[model samples]
Target: MAEHKDYYALEMKIDQMIDELQGLCSQNGLSNTAAEEVVVTSVFLYKFLSDKYMHNIEKFAEEIGESVDEVLANENDELDAFYDAYPTDVVFHSTDTIQALINKSGQPGFAAMFDDTLERISNYQENDKFKVSTAGGEKEPLFTRITENIIDKSKRDAFAVAIFGIISESKFDFSDAFGGNFDFYSTIFEYLIKNYNVASGTYAEYFTPQSVSSIISKILVGMSQVDDNKLYDVLDCAAGSGSLVLHLANELGHGKFGNRARVYAQDVSTKSTRFLRLNMMLNGLTESLDNIVQGDSLTSPSQYNVNHDPSSGYKKFDYITINPPFKMDFSATRDEIESNWQDTDRFFAGVPKIPKKKKESMAIYLLFIQNVLWALKDNGRAAIVCPTGFLTAQSRIEKKIRQRLIDENWLKGVVSMPSNIFANTGTNVSVLFIDKTKGDDDKVILIDASKLGEKRKEGKNQRTVLRDNEINQIIDTFINQKAEDDFSVLVSTKDIKKKNYSFSAGQYFEVKIEYVEMTEDEFNQKLSGYVSDISRLWNEGHQMEAEIKKDLGGLIYERK
Candidate 1:
């Protein structure tokens, strides 16, 4: 629990490594930032595997039926050539091997090496000696994305040297950081997405900030803990890079939860889906890699099935967490969804109308909400991130959704967060908690945390950052259903309905009227000012009347 010194140091080294590669690519003919990102992330993975192998090389050697020296000296190199070609100590020894390979075969050769390395790493199976998981097999290997058309010798060499230097850095030690329960690799994955350009396709995988994810994860896990023996099936329909689900997995029980609880995630981005598999493997939930699927969660609801009953076709989960895409074009598949799911109640609130222009801002989050509601089990609970306007907006869909929550008694609480909680977008967001297990509790807890974040500059934009204590406070207040002045309020469902299905805490918060007792001297001073003003007005009126009388007397002769 102490400061993650080594973790932060490792992250810095990776950043330095990225900068080194960027510099090299600039000097070379290659300037594609996307390619550089892939190279940097791939290098990190290589180093991660190298460290794992180095930790247990003797065991690995015994399993391969080779001596340590022979294994160290590139023995029968059929599988994992990178591991065979370079010994544990010499893998990152120098860029000599890589440079030689590049000289012999050029950029295509280097790209192939990366492709093979990544493929081996992803497909590597779990063994008793080393319980490791692979990440790149579900999609086209990352190396294939790089081609000779865009790469040349100088670019290849620069990437190789930069990666070798980074892996060789003295500060990059996983033993120290991974000694405890700290997740160093997951942090590294976050850094990869944070610093680099993973925004290539039609829909970029935007990760939810750790602060927000932590709060939602903690609350959902905490609420779901009411019955630990009951296996809780958790799902995130729109699991971007799988950060939200990973955090939930970490909070729930790590590998322990992997056995009893089933984690499901679906994303439309193939690239992000692969990234998600890597994230799960890195977190020690090697079993969870298969649970993550690649496809549009809305249209392809195959994995959303809870009991795995094709007869029901629709699934339910004990717990769900999602930060779905804000605005996306589901128009191509919208009608099909409407027609098929019309009777399913998933779109009972009403589907968003596809606009003629700028179809990007369509209300995709609403569909996700309805899906969560349908997928949630009878006693299930869900934590979802949505636009703040969704809470109080009088739109037909928004109102109907709110009304359903209140009427069905599934509404738990709404935490109104500050603007810019998500650094990439300016739209303010809130976490809507739903619990279907309510025992006739008509009151819904609403916590206005809009003023709770610490203001900080993240790049060119300002973001509201919430510390752990603040996040815990929000959860605590909601769990205990406390109504603190100006911070949280517990409102009845009838009142919420009366207010036109508004779930905003600020609207229901009691306005305190404070009366200040006036001292005798202060009262006299105020009265004295009023008296002086009245006297001045009376004198002015008399002076004007006298002036008019004098003017009339003087003008009488002239009028005659």
Candidate 2:
């Protein structure tokens, strides 16, 4: 599999390149290390795109209805020269104007060259006919926020030279490395996010541990029947770096959905959108890049409206998934959401109460849950990562959401996962599966997987790592609606209602109590032993008290 490729080598090379870039940035007085990383990585992406273009020259030419050599002859002479001497340290000359500016090798020159090069490669203004769609998007260029002043001109040349050397001679061919499988790229991106070579954020915003994504993806795909002719629209309303959506796309897209499964990703973070689009490109899912939107998913969802109507907006999606921000202070936008989307169907459960102070703990997940319900088409299934408390909380909104899921019969099941499943947060989480199609089905599968993970510490925070077998077991039990003792149970909606709409597996699972039987003689012997031990301790306590008194008597009193 492509995932087993020598990704370590690529990681090592990228690390080495980043070290050089950072060293140059530090020397050049670039205080904003985060911006430096972003700009440099953006340049690296462009280099990869350019290199991929060169390596696949024949294919690209054919797609554009041109002869390969003819197309190559018309390409930028400097890029062509650099490609010719690639994989070697041979010095190459470039006739391109950007190269001329860089040759000046000063602050202004480097900035000018950097700006021109990025625009030429990404914006494709230099040659409109030959454009890499990755960079020519309607949204602002991914690195538009990167200003030329980020690094000094002298440092810019060093950065440029280091980046050029790394890209030109590197053995990593992203296309060949990816080999049509995105998992390897996804892992590499995760590694980058960890190393802080990508956007700056809490790691949780960029990564959903593969174990979690794996479980969600497997369960979601297993529960849904894929139709080869149907285009499954997979959405991650809070798609942090696009891990969940990409996993779903890779897993479900290959089966009956084929390439027909389009991905819709939205995140409120601009940095997240950048990482997400790069993830999609790395996975060769650049076709769906446009669907990755940057905006507040709650108040201003940029994709198809969650509240879709026949007369106006796009159709509802076939599948929806999200691991939304567990808690956020949406007080700023609360008025807008409440005033505009007052329909009970939107925030059907109830809006989280606006706390006057310290509103960061507001239960945004409830609203996301409602959004998922609205976004999904009839018969659609959604697997959402939620705080485990949501399943059992007596809070008004929390209970209302659970009750509605039960009464409306939208909930398929709830898997109570172990605490620290997410390394970034300690909140115990659960994967709530809601199937609109299964509304008529009374049984709701509740699995207590809270104890199923291998307990381990990840840095300061603890996490539960679910093995492949355990993941599969959870999926199987839920999909087959199998009720096992102490592990999972299939409870009817009636039973759930009786339990006050509590989806907690513990609430329904029968607790078994075991007792050991003993004869009269055995009980008497055990009782006697306990009595003797207690008597001995009593005597010892008296003797210790006497010894303390004697020791005090030995001390001389110094009276003032």
Candidate 3:
């Protein structure tokens, strides 16, 4: 190797590439889409270079020889190794000294050997495996392609698996090594799943995507003010790929809640279960790995609830967050969830008839609703994701569920998300934030976040990612709710009944910016007039029905 150059020169060279790329793109009239690709890819390259030559600019100069172009040309599969040559953190100091340390510490050697040996150890793993890891896993995942923009079936499968693998380390960056460098989803399910396959078993579903993740994180962070640190029994009843609960560990941070706030993540799919564990490890949340499990919220119960009921002194979560499959039918098999509810002891005061088919009925969401209630401690707060069907359906079945929850006072407020939040499923979904212990029992806060995200390219997944600021707005609305004209509403229990108990956020709220200016008294007069008109019509309609009935009766009598 050669003596290194200064960090400033190295930084300028990368910036120079970006500026040139920008000019070239501009000359070509590149679309925003195309330009974005170049920018991100360029950033990735720069990041690689910065990591590789942070201390050893001489190494970069020598590697480049005549020009940076020549150096880049020589890189192929070996590019990854070059980039991994130095830890980005190590670059803050001198290059010569760093290289000496790399040679001396055996750290570089261990990493190199690990890289070469991982393949052999991972031969048994396939492309779409999801696994689990210990608490010390990586919060910022290695080799996940979440920000990539490609969205085909193969990519979908890969992204789905990758989503699971990073959490568990079940998949070992296989896709990162093999999959073509296409950008669309934040990561590939297939690649990540196989890259981190440390699961005890295997397959219910793939990973939940970024759009959904943002919504989930925002809710938990919002709930942190009232975040019951002692609520360690955290559960993602619909724990797809295990990312949601693992994220909980990351968001809550180490010691944010001390050892008291542990997570218990469950998914119906073996793949998801595996990924959940892997995610825990990748996110350095392995302490809760043992707590992460696989179970069907709708139909099956794992050993956790049956063998380790919290009431029996087994510790469970204080908060439960779920993003269950939307519109899944488990109506026919409601009774099959023996561990969850059918076990008479676990069954609550209300559960509807099981659907006939697990695939088509909405029973899965229902079971999740019931299960979360059961899983919660007396005052646990749960922020679960369910489709608009849960909030808007007008069937007797739905009514009973809503009633049961409200009667039990487990129903809290609901947060309505933007359309296309899932980006993949495309179903209109909402976040139902419930408190096992009721706060103010008479009102429910409803927020419509439909206007929050930017347009997303993946399937119905939109991108209204709630940053801390946006999340605060929502939390504040819920905490000190006064209905806004076009965004949020604080509806009383009586109003819910007046509106037929429909919890569709859009039905009760909107983002229509049109201002209807009027004094309170003016508005009240208009409301009173409308009410009087409706009453008059009701009376008239009754009179008309009576006259029709009398005529019909007289006609019948004459005929007799």
Candidate 4:
């Protein structure tokens, strides 16, 4: 990135404020150094041209109820109020000037803004659009997938202006969007994940996680279903902004999940973890936020937080949902995973050993698949986004996983999505629904929704969503286990296993393929012309060969 020359001025101002706040806070037992760190980050957010902070600059300033300078001047007594004001949860020691310098780098704290965890958060945009599927002739946002981008407040105005320029010809989905501005997510966080970097594969406009308030609402709906409510865990292994958890807490009408489905979110990124806490608090979900922890859930539980484990000792969940990075490599940790694998372990059955060179092919998601299974209770269910490859690819391991579920649990159904279901990324995704316990029938349902709705106006770059009727079919397929000639099919696990665990719908169901008809006369004329040209060329070649032979014979006689 081109370094911002103006950041020096901004940083200096915050540095001065930090000194003032330190002096004021000393009597109250607060470190002036920590206060300075806040000022430095706030300044960096305002002056830097980072996609992460520039977008949310003003909001961060407003939320904290003071300019970056004022925070630094405030005393230790103001620490709680200051923390309450900002929308992030980063802790800074008074002496941690190194961290201030690090934040100035404009890097994501971890998950490399483009890492798979952040990718999962970004993928939700396309997933949400694709998920507006059919269920029993009614239109509903499937799974209520919401997308957001949070940034430091300073750049909100400029970033909005920039987005306005980029989308000059395009429009935004303000109707569905919580706020009128498309840049709302920019102000959500300021801490960079320790390792996050932007990737070419990222579909989201920037590095910010999807908005916390928006995602939690969706999980609440899933948890609030009329019957049993014990299933919702508000789980996010790559919880970027803690948006889903925060939103879920707000969405809860009353006692929910028997308070059983607590928000359990983790990420390898300390920046994300801290931001998750801040967002949870900013959104009034801090009580639930305390339940949110940090760690690499895909790996074995972190050694730092040793008390809970989804594998063996921790309480089991009723509902689990997460957007883990798709297809990451863990060849290095394979052995460690096996040795310390949890008792109620998500990887109870263990994964096939993949060669180190071909580890990318190992599909990091396979670990998530096993982990989710281990995390669930006998009555728990999970709905997750799977790449189309999961449905089309055939492998011994995939089949083994499927067989284990068919022979043991409820692998309820598959929902095929349109090509642009996740156009921001290469792989189009489908939803994999697995029930730890079968509802009534043992058979699984399938719905082919390659064609959902009109392409959305705001993002002409890709897809639209499903109308009410289309959404209804999805619900009906799962609810009734009905087959719609080409769109849906209900099959037993035994039958799927007979086909060697094939999940490809087109192979089992004859999907319609549109063909173009050509006139017979046009075809015949073209064929005849090609034949005539070939014959002429053949005769020319024969004449050239005869001439060459005659010349060779003449040369031989002359030599004699």
* Candidate maximizing TM-score: 2
What digit string (tens of lDDT, one per residue) describes model 3 on residues 317-415? 567777766566554455555444544534453555555555565455665666676667676777777877678777665676676666666666787
Candidate 3 Cα RMSD after full superposition onto the native fold (Å) = 14.5
Q: On residues 1-560, what C-alpha lDDT tens digit does candidate 4 reach at each position?
A: 11233433433333443344333334333332333333223322222212222223334557757674455445354444544553332333222222233332243332121122223322434223211111122222211111112234343333323322222212211112222121222232322211122235333321223322232244224423534454345465555655444444444433553433456666665445545554443343433544454556655343214335545456566566555567656777777776776543467556668675867766777777777776676777666656767775667656667777778747777777766544355466666777766755568777777776556533334644565576655655555567888788888777777877767666678657897677999889988999999999999999999999999999999999
TM-score of every candidate:
0.78, 0.80, 0.54, 0.52
* lDDT value, residue 59 of candidate 1: 58
Per-residue CA lDDT of model 1 for 1-560, tens digit only, reads 22577556656766666566566555655555656555555555555545655544555667778765665566336225534533322123212233223343435456556555445444433221122112222334322333332455446544553445555635454544445342555556776666542354311245887777777877777665544454557899888777787787677763433344567877777656656756664666554445666777777775754357586566778788999877888899889889887877778988899899988779899999998998888888898899998988989998999889999999888999988787777888999999898878888999999988798886676878888889889878877789999999999999998998898888998989998789999999989999999999999999999999999998997899
Rank ordering of all candidates by TM-score, starting from the highest: 2, 1, 3, 4
Instruction: Please provide, for model 2 over 1-560, each residue's C-alpha lDDT reduced to its tens digit, 9 standing for 90 to 100.
Output: 13444666665665565566556556566635667657656755665565455555555566667776675567575346444543221111232222344355445455456566566444543233122122223354644434454534445556655445444544344544535446667656675556452233334657888877877888888887777777778889888788888888877765453476688888877677777877776776765765766777787666774345666454477788788888889888887887778854778767887898889888888899999988888878888999887877898888887888888898888888888777777788889988888746798899999888798875555778888799889878887889999999888999999888888899898878998799999999999999999999999999999999887777744331
Among all windows of ten consecutive residues in candidate 3, which has the lowest summed lDDT? Answer: 177-186
Candidate 4 runs further than 4 Å off? 1-197, 205-232, 242-253, 256-261, 302-312, 342-345, 352-361, 453-482, 510-560
Candidate 2 error regions (>4 Å)? 1-32, 58-68, 74-111, 125-138, 145-151, 170-172, 196-202, 255-258, 305-314, 455-459, 515-560
| Backbone N/Cα/C clashes per model | 2, 1, 90, 61
Evaluated at residue 221, the lDDT of candidate 2 is 84
lDDT of 4 at 331: 76
- Please list the Cα RMSD from the true structure of every candidate, rounded to 1 decimal place: 7.2, 6.4, 14.5, 15.6
Candidate 1: worst-modelled 10 consecutive residues by lDDT: 126-135
